[model samples]
Target: MWTIMMILLISLLIALFEVPYLRKNAMKREMLVFFILLVVATGLGIAESLEANIPNPLDWITFVYKPFSDFILGTVE
Candidate 1:
């Protein structure tokens, strides 16, 4: 899909710009963090592509905030 292509293209461009600096500076910590993030992102992407139901963090945030939002609306109106 075009969306995937665009994401890949942008990621490639970012890596092209950022990777040499990291390599030149011997930024081991930065490279480790980047690889960890890449693995997490790839796992999520595969789960989504497979249509597997996954609990999203946003759901938890909304669950926590819904009561406060309702209370605020009740008080304002």
Candidate 2:
């Protein structure tokens, strides 16, 4: 719970520090992208803190390539 709170607090601090520059410079697109990335990062951080089972990207790659690797080994043999 404290880890989740810390992640949110850090994200909030980042936004507080950055939002004004974006607003002052009229960077609407950048602001939109920033918020989107911040939300994604914060959600992932919270999920990790909660010990949620997030799938690794490499797992998917290994799954996809396992058959190809097996075929290559068979051909080499």
Candidate 3:
């Protein structure tokens, strides 16, 4: 789809501009992190374009902490 193509093209453009500087400076770790973040962003963008129901990160945070919170509140009561 057009949205997917646009997402890829934008990511490619960002890499084109950034990758050479990273390579030229021998920044291996930064380059790796950059690629990882870029891939994650691109995948998220494509998923959004396709109208996928991406779960909010906060939901995971709340799920993880809810039990602890409940226990703490019970102790306080």
lDDT tens string, model 2, 1-77? 89999999999999999999989996688999999999999999999999999999999999999999999999999
Backbone clashes counted, model 1: 0
Residue 77 in candidate 2, Cα distance off native in Å: 1.4
Q: lDDT: which candidate is best?
A: 3
Regions of candidate 2 where Cα sits further than 4 Å from its true position: 24-27
lDDT of 2 at 50: 94
Reference-based TM-score of each model: 0.61, 0.78, 0.85
The 10 consecutive residues of candidate 1 with the worst lDDT sum are 1-10
Q: Higher TM-score: candidate 1 or 2?
A: 2
Residue pairs with clashing backbones, model 3:
none
What TM value does model 1 have? 0.61
TM-score preference between candidates 1 and 3, better one: 3
Please name the candidate that would achieve the greatest TM-score relative to the true structure: 3
Instruction: Show where candidate 1 strays beyond 4 Å.
Output: 1-21
Could you tell me the lDDT of residue 52 within candidate 2? 96
Of models 1 and 3, which has the larger lDDT? 3
